[model samples]
Target: MQTVVQAAAWAQTLGLPRLEAQVLLLHALGRAPHDRAWLLAHSDDALDTAVQATFATNTQRRLNTEPVAYITGQKEFFGLTLHVDHRVLDPRADTETLVEWALSCLADTPSPEVVDLGTGSGAIALALKHSRPDAQVCAVDASADALSVASANAKRLALPVDFHHGSWLAPLNGCTFDAIVSNPPYVASDDAHLAALKHEPLSALASGVDGLDDIRTIVRQAAQHLKPNGWLLLEHGYDQSHAVQTLLGNQGFVNVQSRPDLAGILRCTGGQWPTVK
Candidate 1:
């Protein structure tokens, strides 16, 4: 048994960054900050082994450029904690911008049907369903492994979302929605980020040479699945806003616009499908 302060100090002595050390200690103790004393009083050699294992895994993965989410097997998005692993893309806080925008768009629509394309870890779909219990939310992913992880998360959160294992809109054939949102693979194959992204599944990150391949496909096909005046929102690379806006405009979307993230980067682009003429 050890105190929280002692465990934190031990982690720091192991060369972990301050935040990582604290987080690992919290996880190892199986106790929240308030339960620190209880955990410390009952800690044993098994607890020490578990803490050391976590520290070694995180440190080695970080050294190898593996994302912390992949190492920790979890990430927080839209104020909800999600289980994550190599099978799915780690949910980023930036993607919450899309969720917030979607919520606003659906505010006046009764029981809006929303579809999340590429629903890794079910972050977007599950979060939306959690917030709007009446909404009919469905998520699709090309990877069955990713969908399995997403399904587990949905069940864990008690959010009822339809999960489909298929690429893009294949599973949504003849299905229409009031809104369609995606945080698709928009990284260019040759981008320097790929060097660091190698730890992630290639299909989950890189698109085509221009990085707009998946974006282009989604824009092209989204109209077929959207109800009249439906909204389509996407999170993209910081530099792809103009191109995305053009793509949306060319596809007859109206009010095409890009929203800046917390960093002021134009990270999300959206537009409305034209109302029937």
Candidate 2:
């Protein structure tokens, strides 16, 4: 039976990245990173067999280009550790920019009602709710499987959010909100990224040929769902900001603008619905 230190060293020798090696080692020992030393001191034959099995699975999946988050079924976003799988797109740091924008918009509004369209793993909705406990937050996804994952996350985090299984604004037909935010499928169908994105749900990543299909639909429809003076904020591809801004402009939204992510990429665009006359 190999000790935890020995197993970790072996995984590293397999050419796995340093962080991945640590994760695999922790999985092999059936312990978290902090517990690795404790498991090493109590190792036995049965534990060794379990460790070997886990290592094989982890190594094989990594070789297949599966994301470590999907492999571990977890991802961290907005300082929150979220449970995730292939059913939903893994939350990325770029999307945090949208959350920060939402928080800023909500700052002046009292008890704002926010809707997260196409919420996956409830990352946006949950993060918003966590920040503004008094705000009314609702999230909807077209995929039942994704909704399930999001619901589970909401429950685990004890964050209150309404989860619905339907496409776009279908579930909230008669409802209106003070703000609407989403990181919709902005990747074009012909995008080269899809080849590497095969491990994730296709429906959650790519849209129509131009990749603006869903974004277009959301832009046109969101105006109706938003209250007077409410805002519609969306995260799109870095290069798609111009197109998204155009879409928001044609929809008659005021104060239209795009914000850059930490990397200075135009990542989010938003506009305010005009107050009724």
Best by lDDT: 2
Writing each residue's lDDT as its tens digit, candidate 2 over 1-277 gives 6665566666677778867877766656555644555645654433457667787788778878888778777887997879999989989988999999999988999999999999988999999999999999999999999999999999999998999889899889999999999999989999988988668899998999999999999999998899998999999987999999999999999999999998999999999999963
Off by over 4 Å in 2: 1-6, 9-15, 33-47
Off by over 4 Å in 1: 1-16, 32-50
Model 2 TM-score is 0.89
Query: Taking the tens digit of each residue's C-alpha lDDT, what string does model 1 give over 1-277?
Result: 4545666666567666766665555565454523455545654434466666665566655656677677666787887889999888888888888999999999999999999999989999998998899999999999999999999999998899999988898888999999999999999999897886667888998999999999999999998999998999999998999999999999999989998888999999999998873
Name the lDDT value of residue 164 in candidate 2: 85
TM for every model, in the order presented, reads 0.88, 0.89
Q: List the residue pairs that clash in candidate 1.
A: none
